[model samples]
Target: MNQSRVTDFILTGFPGLHQEYYGLVSFVLFLVYFVTVVANVTVFFLFATNRSLHKPMYYIILNVSACDLLFSTTTLPKIISRYWFQSGRISFNGCFVQMYFVHYLGSVNSFIFLLMALDRYCAICHPLRYTTIIKKCTIHILSVTAWIVGIGAPLALVIRAYPLPYCGSNVINHCFCDHIGITVLACTDRSPYSFTAFVGAMLTLLGPLAFIVFSYGSIFVEISKVADPKSCVKSLSTCSTQLIIISLYYVPRCFVYLASQVGITFSAGLRIVIIMLYSLVPPMINPLIYCLRAKDIRQCLIKQFYITTGRQKAQVFAVSN
Candidate 1:
C-alpha cells in the first residue's frame, strides 16, 4: 500500500497556541466538564427529589438541564482526551457515532428549549388557560417530539456519508467529525448534499429561532397588558433571560453554520466565537438563567443544600456511634 493510502487523520489543536497548552487546556476543559455535569445533575436531582417541582414548568426546566448535560457530555470529554492523551484517533465508525451524538443532542437542546420558551409564554401570558392547555400528556408528547426531531433529521446524512469509500486522507481536520469534516471525505462529489445540509441547519438552528421569535413576540404583547409599572418591569426579567441565552446560543451557530453557507469566511475567530456561544454559554449561563428567572428552581436548590448537609451530619453521627 502506498503512503498516500493511509486511513487516518491528525488534529493539530490551537493553530496559534503552544503545544504545552494541551495539558493546561485539558485540565481547564475537565474543570468545565465537572462544573457543567454537577450543575445539570443538581438540577436533575432537585427536580427528582422534590414534589413541588413536578409542575410542567419545572419538568421542562429539568429536561432543559438534561439536554445541556447531554450536550456538554457529547463533545467536551473527547476534546479533552484527544488533546492531552494523544488518544484522539477515531475509527471511521467511531467518528460517525460521535457526529451523530453531537448533531442529535444539539438539535434536542434547541427544540426542547424552544418548547420551554413556549411553556413560559403560556404560563405567564395565559395563566388561566396554562394548566388545561399544557397538561401532562402534552408535556410527554412535546418532549418525545423534540427528541425525535433531534435524532431523526440527521439520519439521511449519516447514511449518505458512511457508505461512500474514503479513498484519500482520512484525517479529520477538526477535533470532531463535524458534518463538513465528514462531507469533505466523500470520494464522490457532494453538490446534492447542499440541500440536505440546508434543511438540517434550518431544522436545528433557524427553525428554533423562528419559533422563539414568534413565542416571545406574543409574550411581549401579553406583558404589555400589565398596567402596573413594577410588574411590567419584573416581567421583562424573565424575557430578558430567555433572550440572552437564545442570542448566545444562536448567534455563533448562525455565524458558523448558516452564515458560513452564505460565503462568509469561516476563519479561526469565527470558530472560537461559536465555541463560546454553544459550548461555554449555554451550559454555564442556563443554570444562571433558571436561578434568576425561576422561583421554583432557586427554592429547590436551597432545599437540596440543607437536605444534603443534614444527611452529611447524620452520616457523621452514625460513624461516631
Candidate 2:
C-alpha cells in the first residue's frame, strides 16, 4: 500500500459549529484579538515611557505582556480568518511554525509567572533582601534566559512531530496547530509522540504551578503575622489578583491535558472552547489585573490622559482665533 503526504492542514475552528454561527464566532474572536493586542501594547507603551515602571516587578510584567501579544498574534488571526473569511487552510510549514510559537510563548509565560511568584515571595517574605535579590539587572538576565529556554523547550516538540509521515486526515479538529492536534494526524502510531508531548506539557505546566502555590502559601502566612490591618489587606489584595490570573491560565490547561492523558472523554467543541478560554482570556484581562490596578500605572494613565486632552483644547483655541 502507498500513501501520499499531506501538504496542508485544514483548521476546523470548532468541530461542531454550524455555518450560521460563523459570523458571530468570528466577531467574538475579532473582539478578543483586538483587546489582547491593545491591552498588551498598552503595557509595552507604559513600560517604555514611564521610567518609574522600570523595576523588577514591572519588568516581569513587560515580559508577560510581550508573550501574550505574540501568542495571541500567532494563534488568533488564522482562526479568526477561518471563521470569518472561510480560509482555514494552513500549509505544512506554516502549521509547524504556528505550533512552535504557540508552545514556545506558552512556556515563556509559565516561566515568567514563576518569576513573578518569586518576586512576590521575596518582597513579602524577605523584604530586606528583595531589593538586593531581584534587581533590574537580575530580572533582565532571568527574563533573557527564560526566552532562550522557551525557544529550545518547544523545538523538540516540533522536531518530533514535523518529520512524522502525515499521510491521511489533514483536518485538525481544533482552532490551531498544537503538538497533540498535529501529531494525531500522522499516519504512524502517535502514542509514543503523544506520550512524550504529554510528559513535556505536564512538566511545563506543573513545575511553575507548584512553586507559585508554595510562594503564595508563604506570603499568606507572612501576611497573617503582620500587625497592621491595612498592610495585611493590601498584601492579600495583591496576592489574590495574581492568583486569579494564574488560575485562569493554568487550571483549564491542566484539566485538558490531564483528561486526555487519563482517557477521559469530552466533546471536541468543548475542548476547543476550554482551550480558547485559557489561551485568550488571561491576555485580555491581564492589563486590568496587573497594570491598571497598580497605583503607579493608574496615576500615570490619568496624567497622560489629561495632558493629551489639554493639548487638544489648546489646539482648538488656536484654530478658533
- Using lDDT, give the best candidate's number: 2
Candidate 1 per-residue lDDT, tens place, 1-321, comes to 533433555544444556777789888878888888887787777777888888776677677787788768777777788777967777777778777877787788788779878887887788799889988779878998988877777777787777766778776666566677777766778767757877786878878889888888888898888899898878777666667767777776766675666887767745754554466557866887777667877887887789889999999999999
C-alpha lDDT (0 to 100) for residue 176 of candidate 2: 94
Candidate 2 colliding pairs: none
lDDT by candidate, in order shown: 0.75, 0.88
Write candidate 2's Cα lDDT for 1-321 as tens digits: 899999999999898889999999999999999998988888888778889888888898888888899899999999999999999999999999999999999999999989989999998899999889989999999999989987876899999889999998999998999998999888889999877887787777889899999999999999999999999999877666567777888888878877977999888888789888889888999988875567777777777789889999999999999
Query: In model 1, which regions exceed 4 Å deviation?
Result: 1-9, 238-240, 257-266, 269-273, 311-321
What shift in Å separates residue 240 of candidate 1 from its native position after superposition?
4.3
> Which candidate number has the best TM-score?
2
In model 1, residue pairs whose N, Cα or C atoms come closer than 3 Å (at least 3 residues apart or on different chains), thus clashing, are 9-171
